[model samples]
Target: MTIVVAVDESSHASRVVEEANALANAFDDSLHVVYVLSRSDFVDMEETNVSETGDAMDLDRVREIAASVAEDAITDANATAESVGLVGDASSEVTRYADDIGARYIVVGGRKRSPVGKAVFGSVTQSILLNSRQPVVAIRKD
Candidate 1:
């Protein structure tokens, strides 16, 4: 059976990878990593989107940063198993990938967030929990 992990190169993500690897080792299953680059991360040089809340980040730059983040997560995951696969998008992307690979479960890392941040950002964990058809295991960073 294949286990899919949603990684973002964060402490939480690392923890998830560790847990996933442990489970994989015990069950003799393969581990797959999915790193999501949000649509807001795709930006063109000529276009500029300014938010009323004054939070503006370059989509193109975010993609580059996300790629770096994915690389780091992949490296960390490799320490456990050399055979690792990467997919983009922690939300829908992860779900699609899991379906594509016929994964039995999805392991996701959830970080502690403030009430305000949670309200505004809408945690990916929550989204996956609500959306995924397969079982989703959310690993928290302690």
Candidate 2:
């Protein structure tokens, strides 16, 4: 079994990685870091015109951008006994991957949000917590 950590661009991601590493060490399990690039991310990039050449970015370009960001997160995760994976559908994909890999725990970062704020902006962490059959650990930003 493995310990799965969901990685994102959030500041709290490093903390979540650290926590996952520690858990993996304690449990003698491998660590897997997963980053999910949602369709909304692609839409946002297109809408915001992230490319300097004003060219329409294809899925490969978007995947490259997402992979670069995920690599940064993995570097922050300390790069010890960790393999990184990427997919689409942020919340569901992470959970599905963990299930497929037979993960012992799913680690994620938690942002401090008021009840109204959580209601207004649904959280991926909340979705993982509710949907994952594996045990979950939520690390907050320091």
Off by over 4 Å in 1: 44-68, 77-89, 114-117
Per-candidate TM equals: 0.70, 0.80
Task: Give the whole-model CA lDDT for all candidates, comma-separated.
Answer: 0.70, 0.80
- List the lowest-lDDT window of 10 residues for candidate 1: 44-53
Candidate number with greatest TM-score:
2
State which candidate has the highest lDDT: 2
Model 1: how far is 108 from its true place, Å? 0.6
lDDT: worst 10-residue window of model 2 = 79-88
Task: Write candidate 1's Cα lDDT for 1-142 as tens digits.
Answer: 8888877656666667778888877788887766666554444321344434355665555655555665577576563442333334558777887788888888888878998998898887888888998899888878
